[model samples]
Target: MSPFDPFVHVIDHPLVQHKLTLMRQKTASTTSFRTLLNELAMLMAYEVTRDMPTQEIQIDTPLETMTGRVIDGKKLALVSILRAGTGILDGFLSVVPGARVGHIGLYRDPTTLQAVEYYFKMPKEMEVRDVVVVDPMLATGHSAIAAITRIKATRPKSIKFVCLLTCPEGVKALREAHPDVHIFTAAIDRQLNSHGYILPGLGDAGDRIFGTQ
Candidate 1:
């Protein structure tokens, strides 16, 4: 995988790479695909939240009192990009159970390859919470871009985008559109197909995760 952009972080942990290879296999079952995606998300969550602010407080330990660091201020907001994003959301929530959840429903128009939003909802007090947008693929970047554009209206403290896979086109499009937002992905594939799907990607993430294909 090539470095597409500075703001795009390609997670290269051994485990992350291993699981991504498994997910890319053509014969991987729906059960395995979904399971692997959740596990992958959990592993990626570590890097995603690495810079989260923390506050120190004195706490009682088993042996004695000591200063402990905890997440500062309000809980994070994990916004899922509808059905496909829910797969990643599950793993992220398992890591940060106290996080507030939100959803943005969008679908790609096959003819125009544009994102059409049908639903949008978010937790209250977004201004106080850092937002992490989760989706499995960033093929065309349409859905991710549109979703983030709407979320910006709420004015969250910060924003990050997480996807299982992406291509140079996707990364460039998103970076050009939202330079302030960082992107985290397991791999950046060769390129996108004519239909706006990532080449060598693990097929349609939503369809594979749901066994719809």
Candidate 2:
């Protein structure tokens, strides 16, 4: 894809859009926000796993035996990128209950505005499984990029990125950094402000979800 073209999936289903509108409002309460985030995460997960492989097997019904299809190979890996990512983890897990959970804790360096990894843990035999990395915001793309970069070292069968909101700049940054990774987002805002926050976007997701700010 060209620099101007990023492989991004924007979930625009009516229900998703409606919940996203609620999420973008400043007056939305933490309880409501958390609930909406979870709902949206589950919806987005549906789109992300659309291409998952499935295999056919024989099954027995009360009346007769029949063929059935089930998810193929190893279970998917759900890796949350720290505090904010955890917000979406539960939602994602709701849909993929059998998915393996992992966490990569990264904090931004105030001075450099770069991501610094604090902790990283993942499921065993990562190379044999598909991975979906979750984070609520892709503002600067630094944390997502850093987290994905580290995850790539494990050589998974495939990898995809998921977020609640992102801007054009962030999409371009991440696409350029990891061209092979597909991105799925609920909405794409206009741009990031001077402070690295999406304009007309919901404020700090971690703080909002945890009622810390």
Residue-pair clash count for candidate 1: 0
Model 2 C-alpha RMSD to native:
1.7
Worst 10 residues of 1 by lDDT: 1-10
Model 1 regions more than 4 Å off: 1-4, 72-74
lDDT of 1 by residue, 18-137 (tens): 999999998999999999999999999999999988889999989999999998434699999988999999999888888999999999999999999999999999999999999999
My TM-score estimates for the predictions, one after another, are 0.97, 0.95
Per residue, candidate 2 scores C-alpha lDDT tens digits across 31-91 of 9999999999988888999999888999999999999999843469999998999889999
Assess candidate 1 and give its lDDT.
0.93
C-alpha positional error of residue 30 in candidate 1 after TM-score superposition, expressed in Å: 0.8
RMSD of each: 1.5, 1.7
- lDDT of each prediction vs. the true structure? 0.93, 0.90
